[model samples]
Target: MLDTSTDIRLVKKAIRGSVDAYGELIEIHKNYLYRMAYLHSGTEDAALEIVQETILKGFHSIKTLRNPELFRSWITRILIHISIDFHRKSVPSIQIDENLPETRSLGISIEERLDLYEAIRQLPEKYRLVIVLKYFDDLKQDEIAGIMNIPRGTVAAYLTRARKELRRSLKEGYLNG
Candidate 1:
């Protein structure tokens, strides 16, 4: 979670031409940004590129930010847009590396996790984005709507549809397995 007052101060300094302030602000949110990017892009390399692009774009346009308190959402909006665009222009692929260390701590078996990931990957782009932002990123529906530039109702609808689809897909996987 961001400290709003500190973010406001850093945002002000960054807007006023303080490179260190901008870097520090970005550093605070780098892991979060990468997670969002990785969830959206489905690849470490693409996620890294998306995060770098988001940081650069944020740096260039920090002065244009109207509310410093909303800096995290603002940068996140940029990352989401870049990720959506990147996905649109590229062929979609899913690569689940079973040996990844993060898989061990989730309590769920790796096979189950991989099945869930595959199910998520099979969802439509809008549904997938909603799932990633809402569940994976732990964003509220209103925040997701804001970041995704969609209505709150639409976000809710997407979540409903996405969850339904995930259930169907995962159940089918279980049956087949």
Candidate 2:
């Protein structure tokens, strides 16, 4: 991971049209962006496309970025916009069946995990987003608020409500047999 001062210097260089500096900065943040994209899109292919698009957009707008220190949040904001657009333009896939076979990947069985993801997927957009950005993306409440353009207190409220809804959904066996 690049230090803040190094990131700031790279951002400065990138803004001056230094492609190498830009590339280095992107490489440093690539994993973070990929994780966010994968969680948002729920597919490797889509996530890869989002990451590529994000890099392009970020590179193009590098000059407009006012704060070099906020590069991660700025790039992340761009990604969030692109992700929203991607989801808006794409057709939602219909699941034909809910019963999942037991298969372990990364030490977690598919049958057990699918239930959780299914429940999360069913949440209303606002609640689902807060949950995903908070837990999966590991973003702080303030960061989530900035991304969602909501107040910090609202983000907290949404999280509390989202957790409650998730608990109720899980308890009802909505996603489980």
Candidate 3:
């Protein structure tokens, strides 16, 4: 005789033996995760795979999570790792043309955002991870540190360096023009 009200609490606790609860988590976060994966991968098929893989792994490891409130950040970190791993194995040399247009434009012209994304794309893994986690995800430095299991000072340094590098890239663009 399980009621709907009790069902929710039960579901949250059912990370041990219930696929339904996992499905609920997926239903809630799948679209957002797919968007994040698409931003990182630039392909729908690859992004879908990343989302699916992330959900699968996260579901299997839910017991390791101590706080339910950390679920989003936890899942996001998993997605980031999975996306980077896929890129490393699949893309050799990670190339990008400085002149290529940004893809996020709709009405306001996403040129700056695209430029930023391109600059980020050129960064080495460590710096790039920090930038994406901080800027793109709009995460606080402390939250980024928590999810990354890193020092907050390291997060700040990465963001600072990433900003400098992006500025250099933009300046190069102007000089070329």
- Give the best candidate by TM-score: 1
Ranking by lDDT: 1, 2, 3
> What TM-score would candidate 2 get against the native?
0.81
The clash count of every prediction, one per candidate, is 0, 0, 0
Residue-wise lDDT of candidate 2 within 1-177, one digit each (tens)? Answer: 235788899998998999999999999999888877766676677778999999999999999987777788889889988988887776675241343322223244566466667677677778878887887776789989977889999999998888888879878433221
Q: Summarize candidate 3's per-residue lDDT along 1-177 as a digit string, tens digits.
A: 123554445446745767887687678677778767866765677778899899888988888876566677878889989998898877654443334323333232356655656677777777888866665566788988887889999989988887777668767432110
Candidate 1 stretches with Cα past 4 Å from truth are 99-107, 172-177
lDDT of each: 0.81, 0.77, 0.70
Once superposed on the true structure, which residue ranges of model 2 sit more than 4 Å away at CA? 1-3, 94-109, 172-177
State which candidate, 1 or 3, has the greater lDDT. Answer: 1
TM-score of 1: 0.87
TM-score of each: 0.87, 0.81, 0.77
- Alpha carbon lDDT of residue 121, candidate 2? 66
